[model samples]
Target: MDFPKLNLPPVALRTRMGDRGRTMVWDVLRRRYVTLTAEEWVRQHFVHYLLEACGYPAGLLANEMAVEVGGVRRRCDTVLFAREAARPRLIVEYKAPQVPITQEVFNQIQSYNSVLKVDYLIVSNGLQHYCCRMDYAAQQVTFLRGIPRFEELI
Candidate 1:
């Protein structure tokens, strides 16, 4: 499969048959046959991109991580941790290529932030990506055209 450039290293992926005539693939870290949903496809690719092209340490990244909000369960696409902070430094929400990067996506991450309270937020659809730094004390967010490099996090 053709994938976009990422910031991290290459990962081994294998294809296998899935239910309902779907093709499943193994996501190494997640260790599961994730359904080939459009969004999932974008997500899988971006995870590699973040590591191969963005220089994000693979050990510091988490995929398909779960969190709770308002007594309900929710999943975050990716969570990046910084060693110095001893917690998640960024939370990412990924959409299908067809899904537009809109306020709804931002709002979803914001809701997650209410609980996780990460310092940065990233939303992407494989095609376009939006990143921002959160300033909780000031109640503000600053948008960036793309995800910052690994060094920038420091």
Candidate 2:
């Protein structure tokens, strides 16, 4: 798969083809190798951008955390935690580079937000990125130019 340059910073990744030509990518955060699909490629790049370019501590990030949506268990792509550890500050949802970011995608993350109550939401497909600052108390959401730095959330 040809991975395109995204809005995020360049990332140096370690990837290899596995048995039956299954591509695998090294997950520095998880400290393991995972299947390298199109979406995963975007995810890895975003992770590196958060850690290297934006200064988000690896300890404060979680990948594929499980949540309940409409009584159905689902996994969120990534979440940035507040210092409290339990409180999530941001939720990131990623799609394959070729996938179009639609309202359904936003709705899916919003469902996760219904449970997380995060202050920020990001949806990306490597080709495009949408960042939103949520004012839950005011029942409003404002789109941003790009993802904010880790310190900005703090």
In the range 1-154, model 1's lDDT, one tens digit per residue, is: 3445433234565777777777787775677788777777777777877777888888888887888988999998899988776588899999877788899999999889999989899988877888899888898889876788888873
Q: List residue ranges in candidate 1 displaced over 4 A.
A: 1-13
Off by over 4 Å in 2: none
Q: Scored by Cα lDDT, where does model 2 land?
A: 0.90
User: How big is the RMSD of model 2?
Assistant: 1.3
**Model 2, span 14-76: residue lDDT tens:** 988888788899987788889998899999998888888888999989889999988999999
lDDT of each: 0.81, 0.90
TM-score of each: 0.85, 0.94
User: Using alpha carbons, what is the TM-score of model 2?
Assistant: 0.94
Candidate of highest TM-score:
2
Report the lDDT of model 2 for residue 133. 96
